[model samples]
Target: MDVDNTKPKPDTVTLRWSYSPITYFEGPFRFKENNCCWEFFDGSATATINAKYPVNKSQIKNDLNKRIESIFNASLIYNHTPYKVSEPFMEGYDSKGNLWITPVPINLNLSVSGPNIVIKDSNGNAIEDMKGNRLRDIEEFAKLSIKYSGDPAAQAILRNYKSAVGEPNSEFCHFYAIREVLTTRFWSATKVRSCLNLKKDDWTKLGKLCNEIPVQQGRHQGQKYEQFRKATNVELEEARIIVKTMVKQFFNYLQNSESH
Candidate 1:
């Protein structure tokens, strides 16, 4: 049998995925890409892409994966906890309503607990606090990172923050990298301290804990193994708090500066 090869193909596709730990915002958060629209909600996200012609599904999947990973990395910086997404499954329909499926494997092991964090509603009212900071504040910081996604300095900060979250043994080193990046990008120590409302002594202590001390977690790379000692849990926690506060404050400063 002969077939006609001049038929038009579908110009749009939709990709869906499950993500965790589940987080709640005031409403669906939406953004636009080159030819795509991404909408993220409580526990799942969907991306709708428009193409002038049929495109490779594999390439679309890879691009979507990277985008989601970057967003989750930003979330990790703000929430101080990790967020993950399952592999995306793509679906679309032809002009005649024939469904096409690109069978991407999805393994969803979502937790049954409440939302990892609850952001403010559309009106910007504050929600309950998490880890001494408002959930809304966390959302705002993540959004700021997304807004500056194209900036090289923002990218470095995000990458280093992700490393800090992943490598507890060398977390102080990674966290300090974030500070260095901010400093290089024109955030002076005085500015950071003022933004975070931290005292000079406190800022000096943070530097000593992360950089000067000869601890296994510190940033002294050339020290002999015998010269370094394990950082206490209390010390690690203190450093984490200080660095996290600095990051949050920096992002907040960026947001305010952008507004005016």
Candidate 2:
């Protein structure tokens, strides 16, 4: 019962589950956002196996272990640290060498009691009574939010989720040793050089233009001049911030809609 209460919870995944093949999920299970547990609605959660694909209990447990490994892999990085794999179901403590920032050891166990598939925390804590397909479920809510949010505020919410939890359904989080993989860098002067294929610091004027354009304008005048070299310093910064913001919003929109 010695759980590491000090570790931060970083607004962990808020998701829903499903068995039907709609939108982003085509497998036996799916994770969804804004999904209710009740079967009254169209996108509500469901048991992983209907009578159709009824897998044996042992097979189900093994699949659950594979899925748990997929969710938290020791080789991969989250917030620059690999998600440490722990023993099945029983809770794990940092012991004497425990660091303050690291997450508690992850649990990898599944069971079936009654008609439910049970997942346990490291300390033998029963986390959820899913129907033996919890880990592989798409983390629906996260997927839906990322795929359906079109507004700036909504897209921003999904961005915050991505920052907190590397996509739970990310390929490595989804394939292989289980799950595959999914920054932006460069300063104003460096950015200009890359766009024009020119040497760094080739033009002092662009640095000025990139700086002059205020962020509130919501427009990028990158093409006003015939050549990328023609851009001035202020215009470069102006164009940089303006174009960057626009692109950011656009991609966020695309990400939020791809699920459905």
Candidate 3:
């Protein structure tokens, strides 16, 4: 009988990945819990996962990507600015210097495009921005998204909100879809508005802008192309702000209800 001498593969591994552009949150922000850790800095960000058992590297990458998405989504919700992170370059290895995964070059160039609104105090010092206290708010909102991850309605609203952020041409339609998600669940515009604590005038105006107007960006596909006019930036911005407020209020209501 021949004895096999091949060493068994290790069960434990550590995976690390980095992505950019760095989040708007003031950093270096660090989180370490549940076998996962991450750090966000001004010009760089990295996340790590310590797996006690064998896990797929691709799955780790996907999870990290979703986290990044949630962070960006939180940014949009709070700052009314659409931000995106580049695909993370990931690698995995064991304690014995055995490489389980190879480092992939980050070839994608992503930009953090938004107004860095800074408030100045008396004299010549920058007082506040979207960082300090706002970072805590963004973190809380992102965690709320994770807490409500099981609810279909909440997920739909988040998905539509993200889509609206990415699609500048059809921004109003996507934002309106968020309201539609609520209306579908509640089955009444009034009830939906009441639940979200939205004003009647504001809700009606949003609907009118998306459904009644003959804009090229209108939600209705049946409208003739020649009959539609482009929606102005002012109209788009108004829709974005109103929808953002509605989402924030809705999330707050959910958080409050869950606590009781």
Candidate 4:
């Protein structure tokens, strides 16, 4: 029998990859027509690999495993969590020639995920505004309120800075923000209208908008209200624009209160 020591091994390898928190895949990587490397399924890892190889398959698998482990180790060293989490993650490299990880992407992206927000410029830097130079939800709102209103009290109201049962204190959602701004007391609804010098027609229109929010506990107009439902994106955008206008107007009133 002739021994072939220089030949590459033919091994059945499995890899798993996961990008979403609740979804994953574990199996052989599909063959890419463009690239001729046996791989894991797109965006997944295999639990284990088993196959026959003329060369030492175990050693090759071991080496690959070590490399992957090192990448994760680098992530830890650089404070980058590899797993798909509430925070985003991406691959990177460090000065020590180790593949690292990052909670943010190497490329700047404007992403708004649930409670977290990321707004990067074309150069991948954080947007610097009155919101403390960090990316956050409602940052634009904050900047606008501060720039135009110059009133912290008004900003607080814009932020919906009070908590209620079933309502988040943060004003990230436009619908909730509109409701808070329209309903919260700058003293009282009457006083707010008086202070702003709003005409009765304007006040009635604003009041009607506030009442557009569906009743949380009971049927409205003989229709059941769904707790999970929210205003459509279109409605939210329109409401946001209207509320923004109102906030600016209210701030102006607050600014000239003594004069008025």
- What is the per-residue lDDT of model 4 for residues 129-213, given as tens digits with 9 covering 90 to 100? 4222222222223233434333445645433422211242112233344435545646466766576655556555434433444
Query: lDDT rank, highest first?
Result: 1, 3, 4, 2
> How close is every model to the real structure, measured as TM-score?
0.68, 0.20, 0.76, 0.31
Point to the candidate with the largest TM-score: 3
True-vs-predicted CA distance for residue 119, candidate 4, Å: 29
Q: What TM-score would you give candidate 2 relative to the actual structure?
A: 0.20
Give stretches of model 1 more than 4 Å off.
1-12, 18-45, 48-63, 82-86, 106-135, 191-199, 221-227
Candidate number with the higher lDDT (1 or 3): 1
Give the root-mean-square deviation of each candidate in angstroms. Answer: 8.3, 20.3, 8.1, 19.5
Q: Candidate 1 lDDT, tens digit per residue, 25-114? A: 323556665566667666777778775335577888887777666667766755566556788888776656676776766666654324
Lowest summed lDDT across 10 adjacent residues in model 3 is found at 1-10
Task: Candidate 3: give the clashing pairs.
Answer: none
Which tens-of-lDDT digit does each residue in 182-240 have in candidate 3?
A: 89978999898887789999998899888888886669746866677888888887787
Model 2 CA lDDT for position 26:
18
Q: State which candidate, 2 or 3, has the greater lDDT.
A: 3
Residue 177's lDDT in candidate 1: 86
